[model samples]
Target: MKIAYFDNNATTRIDDLVLEAMLPYLKEQYGNASSVQHKLGRQGSHAVEHARIQVAELIHANPKEITFTSGSTEAINTVLRGISKSYRTIGNRILTCGTEHKAVLTTCEQLTKEGMAIDLLKVNGLGEIDLQALEDAIGPETVLVCLMAANNETGVIHPLQEIAEICQRKGVLFFCDATQWIGKLPLNVEETPIDILCLSAHKMHGPKGIGALYIRRKSKPIQIPALISGGKQEHGLRGGTYPVHQIVGLGEAAHQAQQKFEIATLRDYFEAELLKAVEESSIPTKGANRLPNTSNVLIKHVKTAELMTKLPQVAFSSGSACVSGDRDPSHVLKAMGYSAEDAYCSMRFSFSKYTDREEVDSAIQQLKEAVAAIRAHSPIWEMYKDGLI
Candidate 1:
């Protein structure tokens, strides 16, 4: 049986066009991008530069400002660690939201242990940060503000432009982890005052193990020391032999993502139908603006772990894939005022442009049946029906 994939925010299936663009590099054009002494190396270097341009074009950034990394995790580490080290003389504090990805939150925790003051801003129940709280948090001791464009679990979008402006006015650098937002939505660095940004290719239908970090070089260049230093690669920031095929795939994915179709209709339909089918189901982040392809639903008294086991043909996530192995409830939901039980019961279904209506219907039917089956054996559900605690 063909599985119904709805965990796109974790990763997407590599597009055929992206694969086609990468195969040549994997087979015949396997020259090292750094070994530019010979014709083959020159060819590899040229291809790498071309891919840089393609990736930059997707975000309306200058090609020179894009630095390739292993993925968004490395990119995030590069920005957070590099900025913290390079700007220590200027400030010692870093501000970030409570709902940011583990890539950001984990790095910040390390920095805090290393004597850097780290402040986590609280988010409302709707998964939005208060702009006034953010602005007030920036002081002379603050060097950087780390925020994500979209929450990986709930898909709630942050006010990026406004946040960037606040950081700019306060003379603090803003670094946005756009891993979940880059290819799905249009972002222009020229219009927004974001100082640094990172995205992974696998989240955008490209091959895994490739990503890019964008640093502003236009007005006043955002300067930071190298995170992984050895040889002169990625502007001496991240040094390693470039994966030409993966870079090529990332470029093609960015190119194709420019024309990706709007998928909100299918997602909305899925949520509406599921809510109608499952009793007492609720959308946790319904009030906030979310990604067009993401729906995070909460079913009271129905544990997602139990429901997931009943529907083996379906693919979804209880939270971000990075920490899926951990039994703890979703940190994103907990940060948004959800109880641990509610967070554990929530399921995230992220769609893609290729997701069809039939798949949504099938997933909904399977989920409804699975949820009913789980609730039937749930003593909590029995208590809920009997109007008892």
Candidate 2:
């Protein structure tokens, strides 16, 4: 059976063009990017720089300000922990949202162990943080405020520009984990005052194990100590021999994402038809500011775990991949005031450039059938049908 995959938020299928771009690096041009004397080594170094330029251009950042790491998790840890090490003396407070990925939340938790204050700002039902509360949270003691440009689960787009203004006014550094938003939307750091931003290539049709960090080098350059310590790659900040092929793939993915911005229409159409077909279906952030390619739908009287087993033709995610194994209902849905049952029934369906209209149509039919079967099998749904809910 052909699978209509809608799990781009967890990770994406690397584009063929990106894979082609990395072939030369993997075979003939294989050389340590750190080596300087040999011709192949110099070529590898030059290729790494070119990839840096490509990734930087995608986010409207300078090439010098971009640094490569394994992925967003490492990049996030590098900034959050590095800041705590360097600027902890200045201020020991870190602020972030409750809906952030485990990378930001867990790192902040680690910081709290070291006597740093970690504050989690609550989000409304629409999964939006209160701007006034954000301002109030930023005080003299706040060293950095970490927030994602887009939520991974709910697909809600946070107001990074306004948040940046607040942090700027309060002299607190703002670090954004833009993993879910980078390839799907336009993120112009030049226009926004985001001090630091993190993104992964795998989220954007790039290879896994490769990502970039955008550090502002303007009037007030946000500096931090190195997190990894070994070789002097990534300007001695990230220490390791660069994976030439993976970096090349990341650059190509960024280039492709910059060219492809029309998939949002397909995603919207998918949600419209799915909701029309399944009366019980509702999108979590339907009217809120959300990513164009994401839809977190809650189908009442159905558990996603049951639906997944039924819809073998559709590939999608119930929630964040990192926490899916924990078998817990989505923290994002729970934060939005969903009951435990509602949260368990909610599922995330993210689209990509490869998701065509026909696939979406087929997937909608499959979903309607699967949800109906699951609800029919559900005793609670039967109870509700008899007015006992």
Candidate 3:
């Protein structure tokens, strides 16, 4: 059977152009970026710098402001640890939303155990942070506010500008985890008042194990405590041997994304088709203002896991890959006021530029059939036939 991949949000296939760009580094150009005397080292350093520039250009930030790391998770951890350690003299409180990724939430939980006070901002029914609640949450003791540009599970874009303004007014450093939104949407650091932002290359058709963190020049660049303290690398924020090939791959991916991001229309077409099918079946699309490439749908009588198992040809997910094993309902859907049953029945379908119209149509057909089959097995459907649904 042919397979259809609609799980782009979990990870994307690396672009061919990006792989071509990284070939030399992985083969002939292999050298430690920290070496000063060797020609190989110089070449490696140059590649790393070039990748930094490409990433910085995408966000309209200076090349000097970018710091390479293993991935977004590490970048976030670096920022959180750095800020908490360096600025504990001023404040020990960090503000964030309840719907953040495990990276941010788990890091905050660890810091709380280390004696830092954490304030989790609540989101409204639409999976957005309550601005009034944010304003009320800020205080002199608040040192940082971390929020994601778009939610990983729900695909709902947060009001980063407004959140940034709030953080700016309160004199708290703001950090944005743009791992989900970076390549799919346009970003301008000058326009968005974010002080720091984290992005992963793999999310946008680049190699995994390489990402960058943007540090605003205007903000008092905090002396971040190093997470991996050994060699003096990444301006001492992170210390490890740099992966030049992966960095180059990330740069090439960013460049290609900048050039071909118009392919987002492919995702738009997928959404349109999926929504039409959902409407025909009387299924409700969850929430509003989701990303162009993502659709979270609730099939009333069908369980998400059962539906996916029944449709083996379709590649999709019930939620984020990180939390897939947990039997609990999605925290994001729960925060949006969805009951346990609705949350459990919802599944996410995320597309990419590489996805074509035919694949989308196939996915829709498979989904429709899957839902029908599952509902046929459901006792609720039988009850409905008996005038009890």
Model 1 CA deviation exceeding 4 Å by range: 218-220
TM-score on alpha carbons, each prediction:
0.98, 0.97, 0.94
Of the candidates numbered 1 and 2, which has the greater TM-score value? 1
- Score each candidate by Cα lDDT: 0.91, 0.89, 0.84
Q: Rank candidates, lDDT, best first.
A: 1, 2, 3
Sorted on TM-score, best first, the list reads 1, 2, 3
lDDT of 3 by residue, 1-389 (tens): 77899888889999999999999998899988889589999999999999999999999999988988888999999999889998899999999988899899989999998889999888777787778899899898999999999988878888888989988888888999999998898889899889999999999999989999898886345567778887889877778899899999989888887864455477666666766775323223344566778777676767788888888889989888888788988777887788997888878878887888888889888887777777667787688667885
Clashing pairs in 2: none
lDDT of 2 by residue, 276-306 (tens): 9997789989989999889999998788888
In model 3, residue pairs whose N, Cα or C atoms come closer than 3 Å (at least 3 residues apart or on different chains), thus clashing, are none
CA displacement after TM-score superposition, residue 25 of candidate 3 (Å): 0.8
Estimate the lDDT of model 3.
0.84
lDDT of 1 by residue, 1-389 (tens): 77999999999999999999999888888899899998778878999999999999999999998999889999888888888888899989999988999988988999888889999999999999999999998999999999999999999999999999998899889999999998889999999978899999999999999999999885666777777788898878888898999999999999998996879988889989998999999999998999998999999988888888899999999989999888999999999999999999998999997789889889989988888888888898999999997
**Could you tell me how far off, in angstroms, the CA of residue 87 lies in candidate 2 after the best superposition?**
1.3
Superior candidate under TM-score, 2 versus 3: 2
Best by lDDT: 1
